[model samples]
Target: MSKTVTVEVGLGDRAYDILIGSGLIARAGETISARLPGTRVAIVTDENVAASHLEALKSGLESGGVAVAATIALPAGEKTKGFAFLQEVVDAVLGARLERRDAVVALGGGVIGDLAGFAAGIVRRGMDFVQIPTSLLAQVDSSVGGKTGINSARGKNLIGVFHQPKLVLADSGVLDTLPIREFRAGYAELAKYGLIDRPDFFAWLEKNWREVFEGGDARIEAIAEACRAKADVVARDEFETGDRALLNLGHTFGHALEAATAYDGARLVHGEGVAIGMVLAHRFSARLNLASPDDAVRVEAHLKAVGLPTRIADIPGEMPGADKLLDYITQDKKVSRGALTFILTRGIGQSFIAKDVPSSEVLAFLRDSLG
Candidate 1:
């Protein structure tokens, strides 16, 4: 069965849908054939995901009668979002001699989506692309938003565009094959919607987190609902010029932590970093009197309850250097004129962008993050 969650971007001609359901790949051809501009296609996936899901996707497309010109299996991880890898894809897209009207399909996690979407954004000035996110993080978060870019030596997702996908097909069953670590990591992003401005959602998460983590019926329903929530916000603020910024509740610090660790090669997964980042956001929110300490404590407690890191000491190697984190923050996309744009929460389900915060104060907080 399928659950449909449609989010109209309100850009008139630029609106889209984010379809969440089980066994979505079977409908991939139908989804693409219905929305995309051209029949020629390119599928970009990572090596890890390809091993498990690539054939099914390709077969699905063929069975759906859509012509797939090429399928590129990227090396999984944040590292693949760099120049050489992007060039390889560009070569493939161009070598295929695809037209601007031709579509690109992102077939893996956020990394693939960012890289492939960016390639599509630039190739022939732009091409439509579809997102078929295989990981939970991509499903509920990355896949829907048009924001796509790879990591730089400077920061995680620092080099990306506000480009949106043509269609997003998030099949919850895909999570079963995902590594447990990655599934747990994605949950951090999953919980973030609640952290940003959905108190009731967060409450639901707390009540059903264990079941959600287990990836069953409750998990599927909640994941679809969470995607709907995010899609609702994205549809309203496509460029993140307003409320969309709220999506980064833990991500501001989470991105910094991921950059500080260079994605840490299993040492610190993106979601784990966000888990810690949320704790820090809560701490800073409480520290700055924007949130109640009790609420902050509750956030931390919940993060820990789900086996997510909630403190600096929980990070590896003395929790990365404060200076390193500070440096990462410097390169953050939200930084401007030497002041940081932090997504600090007033409490669960309520976050606001705190701009003009001094680097010195942020550094001071990072210092405290070490313990």
Candidate 2:
């Protein structure tokens, strides 16, 4: 029952708003139709979430008089963010005979949103898509920006497009059904907002961990507020020209770990990888004298307080070899001339984009963190 925060992505004719609030899912059809006006709708979801809230979502859209053709469900996982599955989902939408006037809905976490959004981007030159994020990670981060693409063997999100959602519906009520482990994983991304640039926000998160985890309305607003912050940045720079890169605060290292871990096959979750990567970025920054060691400690402490991973050892399974960091991290988009352009924190609230971080130094710090 809080105010609905709006982040307008100023794309001229394609500009859209991200409305964040609780109970918003109930009104999804009306809001989505207001922006997306396509008569035919395809609800793309994963098996996990489809079983729980698919009916409610369908009813919402149906009540708004939107005709839903088919509901496509993909298997849930980080592995789903790749070509093979995306092709099938696209096929499903096509089989439904959706035309240029129709739209698709992504109703799940990052995996579904990314894959479905990719389908919306390429199938028939372009179609509208909506994000009904069931997970905190997607609700606050991935589902907002128009960055949609699948992973490649070369790296993560290597094959993607910037297909913005017509509207993003984050139903906070969905959080209660999420497993505690999954909730913790999403919290990593939530903490990342502060680690990247909002140090005071990080401190605030540390003080209110219980309310956030146990489900407090104010904390829900905080998540929406963070989404608004990111939405504003994405609105200004959708294609990551300048300010949008700020959103990738811990993503460079986090992505490298995900690649190393092979998209978390019995290894780590996306947010967990991000948790480890953020700490490494700061530590490597300190090793190069570009960032302070105290900053790294505080980052680690905050991650640990939430029971999130902050080191290599925290990875539950055998992760990628630190000795192979150059090979793994070198695939990042930020890399050039075999050097990783690390996103490092100068202090708790200050971060800077630093390039020329030696691959060797990054490897050494990775080794130290694992111990």
Candidate 3:
């Protein structure tokens, strides 16, 4: 019975609502049924999520008289977002005999959302999909944006499409089941919004992050704010042709690290990589005199205080050398016409896209970081 906060992603006819609150999953069937009457749905989730909350979701759907045409549960983790599983999900949806008007429900974290969304986008020339993001990362970021795809052998998210969801249900209550580490990793992305262009929000988070972690009004407010920030950006640049690229703030270096680790969760997760990459982006900006070194230090301090990895050395196990890491960066999707593009900063809340960055400069920075 908690209050629901709704944020709209304005895309003309394609617009949708992101409903944020507690107990949303239990109400998902009713909400979705009202939006697309008589349409059946296929629930695509990961094994971990299926074991935890699938029953509750199913019961909710059944209560609303929504039929689950099929259910496909893949293995959980970053590795699941690849060609093999993508094929598996596509086939499951196809095998279910779901018509074009049917829906695909992504019921887990970013991996499930991305993979299921990609399947929904391509199957039968695209089917309607609803995103019930169970994780903090999915709720605040991936679930809202239309970006969907699997990992490429070359890089993370290199093979995706912009497939916006029909609706997004973010149940803050679900996050209570998240492990502390996973929750903290998600906090990194939440903090990214502040660093991207909301210095005041960043300061607010600095003061109220503890309550956000504890959950309740603070947690819902924080997630809603992050979603609002992203919704505005996505509405302005849905295709990521211009200003939307700013959202890639920490992704360049972060993707490189994820690639180097071979998508090994034990080594690093996406948000952890992003946390470290944001720090690197700031430090590199300082090295180029684009921002003050104090800014980099402050960024690192906040991330670390929240238990996110903020440095190369923070990663567990032996990491690849600078040259190897650089090789991965070259394969990143941000590379344009063989040149590097990065979201660098001039100061807190002052990020801009830097294009055609010299490879030599990046190499030197990587060497220093690796050392």
Largest TM-score belongs to which candidate? 3
If scored against the real structure, what TM-score would every candidate get?
0.93, 0.92, 0.97
Q: Which candidate is the best by lDDT?
A: 3
Per-model CA lDDT versus the true structure? 0.81, 0.79, 0.92
lDDT of 2 by residue, 124-152 (tens): 98888888899988888888888888878
Order candidates by lDDT, high to low.
3, 1, 2
Candidate 3 regions off by >4 Å? none
- Provide the global lDDT of candidate 1 against the true structure: 0.81
Worst 10-residue lDDT window, candidate 1:
2-11
Question: lDDT at 187 for candidate 1?
Answer: 87
Q: Clashing residue pairs, candidate 1?
A: 146-163, 146-164, 197-349, 198-349
lDDT of 3 at 73: 91
lDDT of 3 by residue, 1-371 (tens): 67899999999888999999999989888999998899899999988999999999999998988999999999988789899999989999999999988999999999999999999999998999999999999999999879999988766788978889999999999999999989998999999999999999899999999999999989999999999999999999999889999998898999899888877888899899999999999999999999999999999999999989999998988899888898889878777788789999998999999998888899999999988
Q: Which regions of candidate 2 deviate over 4 angstroms?
A: 1-3, 319-321
Q: Which ten residues in a row have the lowest lDDT in candidate 2?
A: 1-10
Residues 1-371, candidate 1: write the lDDT tens digits.
54554544344566677776678787788777777634778999999888988888888887877889988998888789998999999899999888888888899988898899999988988888888999998888888768888877755676767777767888777888877778878888888888887888888988998888776677777777777778778877887777787787777788777766666756788788788888889899888888899988888888788888877677676356778888877778876667778888778888888888777888888787674
